[model samples]
Target: MSIEVSNESGMDVSEEDLISVARFAIARMNVHPAAELSMVLVDLDTMADLHVRWMDLPGPTDVMSFPMDELEPGGRPDSPMPGPAMLGDIVLCPAFAATQAKKAGHSLAHELALLTVHGVLHLLGFDHAEPDEEKEMFELQNSLLAEWLELRRQARREAQLAERDRRLLGKAGFFDA
Candidate 1:
């Protein structure tokens, strides 16, 4: 998957990590490997403008998804081969997210991660407009985010262990100076 993340929010957000999160979410959803996704971090002014133009809302929101080809997950046996598609764009307001993070009692990174997955799901035809849809979409989104977080934690743990082993080997004169 081609996951591109651009940061124009002027905040201290982790662009690379957000890109990884987007990639992980797309893979988990079984999107085509050639599918492309764009994630943009914008300031409050830009977000408010987008909100007014697209959603006709009054204020800046946390995240908004504008789908392109309306791609869906592909894992069914009867389904045809998954082909390349432009997934869509996810516009995130980091400034707004920070306030939401404070209210949710989590870090900005966590909030962004969740929003990224939520935006991806939306691109894949998920929505929360109705009660049932909201429940299903939110449950799936939460599960995907939790699994990705666990995977990241495992990767960090493995990296730490590998570094420890390398240091131990060096201390035991296992390498040349």
Candidate 2:
């Protein structure tokens, strides 16, 4: 999967982290390998303009999704491969999302991760218009985020362990210093 991220918001947000999160979301959801995703971080003004033009809303939202080719989740390994497609664009307003992160008592990175997952789901045809739909979509979103975070933590722990082991080996004259 290819996830392109453009940070034009003029914020100090970590572009690498955003790209990693998008790649994780796409991979966990089993999206097609050839599917392309574009994530753009915009200023509030740009987000507001898009919010108005596309959604007819009056204010900038945290995130908005514009799907190109409607693609379904590839849940199974043997599932018939989907042809190359544009997974769509996920427009994020980092300036607006910062307020949300403060309100939610979480880091900006956390909020962005959640929003990224939400946007990807929207592109995959998930909606929360109804109560039941909201429950289903939110539950799935939360679960996906939780799982992805756990995976990240595990990877970090493993990396730390490997480094420690390497250090121990080096001290024991296991390799040329």
Candidate 3:
């Protein structure tokens, strides 16, 4: 997928990390590889204003999505015609996410990662208003996130092991340190 990420938050989040999360989230939705997504990382005030104007919610939420070309409810979407399909924009508030991360005892990066996934799910037309829908949607979201996280953890472990092996070889004068 083509992911366009713009940071208006002035926060210190790594752009590469943000892009990685966006790509992972969109991919988990089984979107076409040619599909596109836009992400805007904004501060709390901007997100709060958007929340008030668009959603009419009181405060700044971590993430909000505005999808284009949404399919009808209960209708499965077909992949785009080998071209770019605009999935939607996900506006995320890093300030709000930091506060929420503090409250939830997690890193801000992790909170933003989760929010990105949540926003992408919204773009795919997942809602949790009713009890049954809530159960279904939350379960799916949680399971997908868990699986993705596990994969990332495994990749990190492999990378660390490779680094350690390289360091050992360097110490043995087999290669440059």
Candidate 4:
């Protein structure tokens, strides 16, 4: 899928981080390369305004997804005839996400990654408006995020281990001797 990411509100988020998170989500979900998405990094005020307008909520949220396609007549949307569909916008508030991450006791980047996955799941027609749906959707999100974060953690661990081994070898004169 095509994930078009922009810092429209000058949020100072790294494009590298966002793209990596998108790549992880795409691989985890087995989404096709042609399925399109847009992620907008906005300020708290923009997010708060959007939240108020869209959900009738008064405060800023970490992330919100506006799914593009609605069920028409019976089946899928008209646009995605022979290819993956264009999912809609994911508006993210970095500031709010940072605050939430502090409360959640995780890195801000990690929290944002979770929110990104949540937004993408929404575009895939997953919802949590009902109790059962909420359980299913949130449990799925938690599992996916936990797996992803653990994968990253293990990879980092392996890399660090490799680096340590290399340094130990060098200190032992294995390379020089």
Model 3: residues >4 Å from true position, as ranges? 71-80
- Residue 89, model 2, lDDT: 95
Best by TM-score: 1
> Tens digit of lDDT per residue, candidate 2, span 54-80?
999998999999988756787335546
Worst 10 residues of 4 by lDDT: 71-80
lDDT of candidate model 3 versus the reference:
0.81
| Candidate 1 clashes between residue pairs 3 or more apart in a chain or in different chains | none
What ranking emerges by lDDT with the best candidate at the front? 1, 2, 3, 4
Write down the lDDT that model 2 would get: 0.88
lDDT score at residue 61, model 2, on the 0-100 scale: 95
Highest lDDT: which candidate? 1
Candidate 2 vs. true structure, TM-score: 0.90
Q: Model 2 RMSD to the real structure?
A: 2.7
Residues 10-86 of candidate 4 have per-residue lDDT tens digits of: 65777666766766765666655556778999998899999999999999998899877542212243554634566
Q: Could you tell me the TM-score of candidate 4?
A: 0.79
Q: lDDT for each of the candidates?
A: 0.90, 0.88, 0.81, 0.79
**Model 1 root mean square deviation, Cα atoms:** 2.0
TM-score of each: 0.93, 0.90, 0.88, 0.79
Candidate 4: residue 10 Cα off by (Å): 4.1
Tens digits of per-residue lDDT for model 3, 48-159: 8999999888978889989985643322445335434788899999999999999999998888888887887888888888999889878877776777778889999999
- Ten-residue region with minimum lDDT total, candidate 1: 75-84
